[model samples]
Target: MNENLRCADEARTASVVELAQELIRRPSRGGIDPYGPVLGVLEEWLDARELPHRRLRDAAGAPVGLLVEVPGGRPGPWWTLDACLDTAPYGDETAWTFPPACGDVADGRLRGRGAADSKLAAAMFCHIAADLAPRAHELAGGLAVLLDVDEHTGGFGGARAYLADPHAARPAGVMIGYPGIDEVVVGGRGLWRATITVHAPSGHSGSRSTTVGAVTRGAHLVRLLDAADLPGGDDGSGFPLPPKLTVTAFHGGQGFSATPDRVDIHVDIRTTPGFDAHAAETLVREAVTALDTALPAPLPTAVTPVAAWPPFRLAEDAQPAAALLGAAAKAGLTVRAKTAGPSNIGNLLAGEGIPATAGFGVPYEGLHGIDERAHLAELPQVYAVYQRAVLELLGR
Candidate 1:
């Protein structure tokens, strides 16, 4: 590496790691913990650097995330670098080799809960925004570094707030700084989620009446959902993953003596372009209808749609993806465009008719699991790729 690039990498790595450690040490487990302390860490860092930023609030005026923007000299398409500050709840703390809040850098890895999943990326993006702010006069488009705290909660309040903000510039594309070095997530399966209520006649267990309990009906529904013939991926559609159906949760029944009247099952369907939300819903409703027909219930089954996001697959030549993929190739990085199995914020963006690249960062292990940590050896290369990609996108 040239002296300039080498120096930049060294400095960037140091700063990013330090900021990441500080944030991780604070413990911002999504929904379980208040976000103020963790958010404060990044806010303080931005304040020290004199970067322009503000809190993104939900409709109820609760801070969901932070937005840092660096506008360019000339008008061009706006771009975003997003990463979540909130993290998954530390499951089995005793199982971790290091404390969940250790945030220690040892064995060439940054060990912590949010290290791989996102806190590290948030720090990196903040530094990138700070670095670009001074050179904004030389670029065309603007850059927005979004540090979302509501991501792990599945609320995506920060992203929603940004998109809803009348004062904020509409981003032409977004690059979510989710960790994984090998693939640039260009698209993800969309989701159609709902709570299905199966109703049955309540009766005493001791009664001789042929009354079916909601639990039994719910089990039957689960079987039907599992047996439902969802279509596989259509190669012609360009989306590589098939539609997925998962019965995530079931709630019903109380005492063993009395049969419950109602049971609620949460169904999560991962949809593809070929099998979209509407198609998935129709299939699910048909299964419900079939179940109700076979085993008549006092009350009809109900399918309440909770959330829906359309699946999307970006072409290789698409903006943001094209720029990042090109930059990675130029940087001699083997990064392939990938469509993720699970839906992400990219799916939500797709619903808004906005394009986004979801994952591309340092390789890591134990994401959303025990010893979650990000390998630091590839930080410089990853940082360089993103920096190059952003510069290219901004017309620098």
Candidate 2:
């Protein structure tokens, strides 16, 4: 390696690790901790570097995240690099070998909650933006770093705010910095999430009278849902995976004294391009209708759709995907493109007709679980790959 490039990588290593540790120590668990302190640390870093950045907020004026952009001298399409600063709640603090916010760099791993799931990527992208700022005039297109604080909460307020901004240029493509070095996530199965309310006659359990309870009806419905068939694998839709359904949550009943009148079931269906959200909803509704007919509830079961996102799969030659994949090869890394089983922000962007490459970074362990940490041994290589990809996209 050239001396200058080696020095740059070393500097990036120190900066990224230091910043990631600082942010991790602040504990910005999504919807749990206030975003101010964590976002403040990042903003301070940007400010120190004199990078142009701004805070994104939701409709209620809550800070959603931060956006940093380095515009080029010439006009070209904008590209985005995204990573979430918010983290999943630390499941059991006592179960952790170290503090959830330990921020330790022992055994070649950065130990912490958001370190893997992605505060480290957030730190890396910030430095990438800073690196581009000096040579912004030499590039063709611009680079944007989106540090999302509302990601793990499922609100996606940060991405929404940025896309909704009238003045903000629509990104040509987006690369979400989710961790996992083996594959670059090019697409994901979209989801149709809904709540089903099962109704039954409420009565005192002691009174008997052969009254059917909501619990009984709900249990029956669960079985029916489980038996319901989804589209089998590879329906020739160009997507490799098939549709899936899961009854995620069920709530009903109180003390044994009384039979509950209503039960709510949360259903999550993973959709593919061939069987989209509408198809999933239809299948679910059919199951509910069958339940209503056989069980004969006091009122027909209610199926209310809460959220839906259409599935997307980027072609191998697709923009951003091609650029990133090529860059990885150029970096002498054999990273393959993958379609994740679970939906991500990439699905959301696909809804707006934007393509994205998600989940390419350092290897991780215990993501969203106990002892979450990102292995730092591959940090330099991962960093170099992304840097090369961004530069290639920017036509540098």
Best by TM-score: 2
The C-alpha lDDT values of all candidates are 0.92, 0.92
Which residue runs does candidate 2 get wrong by more than 4 Å?
A: none
Per-residue alpha-carbon lDDT of model 2 for 270-382, expressed as tens digits?
99988998899899899998988888976999999999998998987988999888888888888999999999999999999999999899999999999999999889888
Model 1 misplacement above 4 A: 1-5
Provide the clashing-pair count of each candidate structure: 0, 0
lDDT of 1 at 162: 96
Model 2: residue 76 alpha-carbon error in angstroms: 0.6
* TM-score per model over all chains: 0.98, 0.98
